[model samples]
Target: NATFGMGAISITSEREKDVDFTLGVMTTGVNLLISKPKIMDSIFQFMEPFSLNLWMAIVGASVGVSILYFVLDYPSEERKFSARETWWFSVGTLLMRGTDFAPRPSSQRILTAGFLFFVLITVSSYTANMAAFLTTNNLEKQIQSLEELVERSDFQCGTVKDSATMNFFKTSSKPIYRKVWSKMSEGGLVSGSKEGRERVRAGGYAFIFDYMINSYSELTSCETKMVGTPFRLQEHGIAMKQGASIKSILNINLLKIKESPIMTQLQTKWWENKRKCDFIESQPTVEFGIKHMAGVFIVGAGGLVCAILFFLSKKWFVAVRTKEKSAESDTGLEETLYTTDKTMSKEDIANAVKV
Candidate 1:
């Protein structure tokens, strides 16, 4: 009687010609193994939530709305003000600070109310989006398929030499598989799965292998990940010499084992409970440092400085105008007094002559 051996032996036509394979015990495929992508740190990462064009549009909208409010709130001739006051009123309203001058006309009041409503909506939406963006993590670009792996030149691809995975790539007629095989052959193939996996962990490389093996590797390695869906559907079966008498008996036992709870217990013991790496979903939200809000604070400081300069210039101009007016009034009064005294002297002299 021939002996039967069972393992992850793939059922292939060439192998079948040499040995008889029992019915498939498990089905799996080949997948790409790669290092987990690292999240990149950026100095201006806070601005990533919105695009440059969107940010520009928001600024433009704020200024446009402010200008509109200024035009609508223009005072009448009796209570007239310089154009500067109108602009200040509009900007103050935009900033949610009530302006010194209240809107008097009904039309002006209505327009100001509508603009405030718009501001409320815009600010609320921005706050909500910003919060979400800050709390959530940004994902790095990932390789999702074999075609992407072949097209990208950044990652070197390889597999264990003389392995099933290597054979699959070497014999594949597809252009992507052919390209991958060419690159791997040129770069030199890995000796075994361990070396291939180590290459992936070191980064800048991707290893192709059986999905089952890759899954087990990911459980044990923290920085390793299995990416892309499996391909080349392969079935694992028991292999025995051709015309082996025990093949029928072994197939029957394999079917029974698959249907029983023993299979589930075995898989759980190996894949889950034996995991070596801690599962991490996301890190804590980073607190915003001075650098994060530096732009906002700088802009505010600039506006305050400009306002102070404008106020000082306006005060100086008013003072100069007031002094000139007072001097002119004094000169006119002195000339009038002198002219009156001369007229009185002439009248008195004429009276004396008549006497």
Candidate 2:
């Protein structure tokens, strides 16, 4: 109830809070007079704060650190393991010989590592992009770059929800970040409605905040160009459970992927294609393409990889079964003829059976 009251007061307060020392002392004194336990007292002697605010500050810092580590660093599914469960499992593994405590044994580790690596790579690429953008002087234009953006003010820039783009806002803010959760929502791009992607493409908003490669892929199908330069960039690589043994394989795969010609070709195909963005306001198709190209590539690649793997595995199993049946048939003719015949000798049966 007290917390609720404080929250209500905070939300309803007309003025911004200025935490002066006088106000703090007055509040602490009033609480003491009201039969409240002295804020300075601590159950644990070592944990005691020098002052009430000092205690509060420590608590606040702990909460903030926890949020950043558990929430911001990874997806929710990874954090679903409870504190008690994680602790016991970890302790048991360290105590018990030949124990692997990791929840993700194989594929999950690979996927997580790959995802993080990709994110790191994207960040680095964006950083380089930002540096290049800053290097090329543009003194003549005031609102020349996508980096100089504001929400519902200048240009509408968007990102995918629960993505690194959302995390980017916590540290960097060169553009207004809007989240489009789905392909359909992205296609619509509604401003002030979480549909910023669709709106940006349609000229209801301007520019998108995404990885350079993603933007490049999108440009292949869309008219909206990745103008000016990248606002932010950092290393985006795969994530693992702090330390995992598959580091060598993960690193190798990442290096191979980066060096591949496929990625280069994809970049060219998307960026080199010319389209009329000036006429984007007139064409619904053009607008849709611009907003939705990035979304399509991501979804399509994920689906395609899954499909190919499934088909190949199915084909391999079929071939193995077919070969096994052929081998069994070849060895069975003599046995079949002898087993059925009561009057024939084994040699006669062997002679009589077809080769």
Candidate 3:
């Protein structure tokens, strides 16, 4: 009688001596299983799109460009303004809330136009990145490779005892695999894949098992995920006693079935159709939160402060100049009156002497 089962049943050299293995029914490999990462809450999560250094660079660029604009548009006596006014105008232009004054010189106008173009490009890029950052899930992966799994000490790793994956690790010649095998032999190995999966779901534990089963388990449970790329490439084959005549016929038919559309339909029916979890890959809804637009409000507040200071300084300068002019006019008028009195007195004395 032919024996067939849907377990791992890999066609290794050791197993080939006792039983015949038909063509691979399913291709799979060992994969790491861990709990799904939780979404972290951060107050400054909105600033995640750009690094601190990048943000600093942007600010530096704006300041440098503003200085360039001020130098290019230096004012004349007819359209005079303080250094502060020129700075304010340049900053306002950079922010796209342009100032009342426009550059009169061709060189200044050209520079201003170039700066506007730069601002346009920068603003567009920032907006697009911010939108993506707010709407997309950028979860940090806990483990990405076998090397990482070995390096991390926060979680204990395990696999089903006497399974194909366990045997692969135990027989491997590589130092990393040898180390993993030692750990597994000590206390990590579990009796069944189900127990290993349950340990993973409980957290602080990692399970190494067949990729196909891991994929199926992830679809069934929402809180568990298959992490990292597969380590050992292996195939599942139908098992039969050695020297079985039906092996050749079964292999031929298996190849035919694989080539047909029936295999794909069966795979879809088993994997996709039976998924228990409601997994949707839709864009996350983004709301206009204060954190998202904090920079805009901050810039507006800065401009308002600058405007207030500029108004006060202008008023103070005008007041001081007006006071100095009044003082000079009063002194000149007094001198003129004294000169007229002296001339009138001298004229009256001369007329009296002649008479």
Candidate 4:
């Protein structure tokens, strides 16, 4: 027969020894944990006597509470504590933990509500994180966008062990998106070729299907332009733990955020704010010098030169037209005068012959 009584004693004794060891190092370990955040050291310190003792105490208390609630002669678990008892117990716990000083009735209510809210939020957040991981991992080859990936060269291209894009000069009816991650990890394989952009910029990686779109955008110093059609218009959403009601609240808020024109405007503003010169990149001085003042000067000077030539051409054209009009008028006058003289001479000759 298993000795339940001895089992309890053995467990308590073991826990007591652990507590003593933990407490022995608590002072030093606490200092180091606070200052350095060394995980190994912290673990060692956590094994100290006092720390172990505290842990044991917490476990023992929890176990005792569970036993009392379940095994004791109580109508229900709800009957274990009255409203005031529950409230005061919560307040005392919070105070002892240095979370709250003195808890008023209203404050207790608020804290209770807040605690519930936080629990919901935490559950939802975890769920969302899990969902994201699953979605991203399940993709055969994941890349945020082609435009984003093509901008850099350091980003690794990954694909399945055998794929079409991996085979150079292979013809295919469908467009192939290259994988970046797998290629980098594979031994004795190299991605060939560099483009004009990479030649100009250092640290540019030609990643195939890496989903680090933001990183690519940063490297390219361009608008976060995505390639091809957007697969989906996705909004960042909160996922919740299974059976958590907080997910609904988050979804509602997300919808409101999506519907708000402010959000669109904010995004536009952000993209605009993120704008960088393709030619100059992060070199603000160069870009500013070129675009702001020097460019204007060059354009102005060119316009001035064009204007001068245009004005001179206009003047020359007007002068040529005036000369042509004057010549035509003078020729017409000369012809009229000659015609009159010829007519007068013919009449005189006729008269003379008749006489």
Clashes of each: 0, 25, 0, 30
Model 2, span 32-121: residue lDDT tens: 000111122225523221233433433343333223223222333433534444444433432332234444423223323333333343
TM-score of each candidate structure, all chains considered together: 0.52, 0.27, 0.50, 0.23
C-alpha lDDT values of all predictions: 0.71, 0.37, 0.70, 0.34
Model 4 global lDDT (CA atoms, 0 to 1): 0.34
Per-residue lDDT of candidate 1, residues 1-355 (tens digit): 4476666678888788888999897899999988875543678866655556556655665565455445544434325434676567666776788767765644445555555665565556557656865666434446878788877778888988987788988999998889989888877489988998989989889998889889999999888888888898999898898998888898899889988988789889989887987655332233333444445434543543444454455557768999998878666655665576665554454454345
RMSD of each: 10.9, 32.8, 11.4, 40.7
Model 4 segments beyond 4 Å from truth?
1-204, 208-235, 278-355
Full-model lDDT, candidate 3 = 0.70
On TM-score, the stronger of 1 and 2 is 1
Q: Which of candidates 1 and 4 reaches a greater TM-score?
A: 1
- TM-score result, candidate 1: 0.52
| Segments of candidate 3 deviating more than 4 angstroms | 38-141, 278-355
Please tell me which model should have the higher lDDT, number 1 or number 3: 1
By lDDT, rank the candidates, best first: 1, 3, 2, 4
Top-scoring candidate (lDDT): 1
Candidate achieving the largest TM-score: 1
Off by over 4 Å in 1: 1-5, 38-140, 278-355
How do the residues 57-107 of candidate 4 rate in per-residue lDDT, one tens digit apiece?
334433343232232212332244444444444434423342323333332
Off by over 4 Å in 2: 1-143, 146-148, 151-154, 172-196, 240-242, 256-355
lDDT of 3 by residue, 115-178 (tens): 5665665566567777776666444335766777777777688898887788889889999898
Q: Which scores better on lDDT, 3 or 4?
A: 3
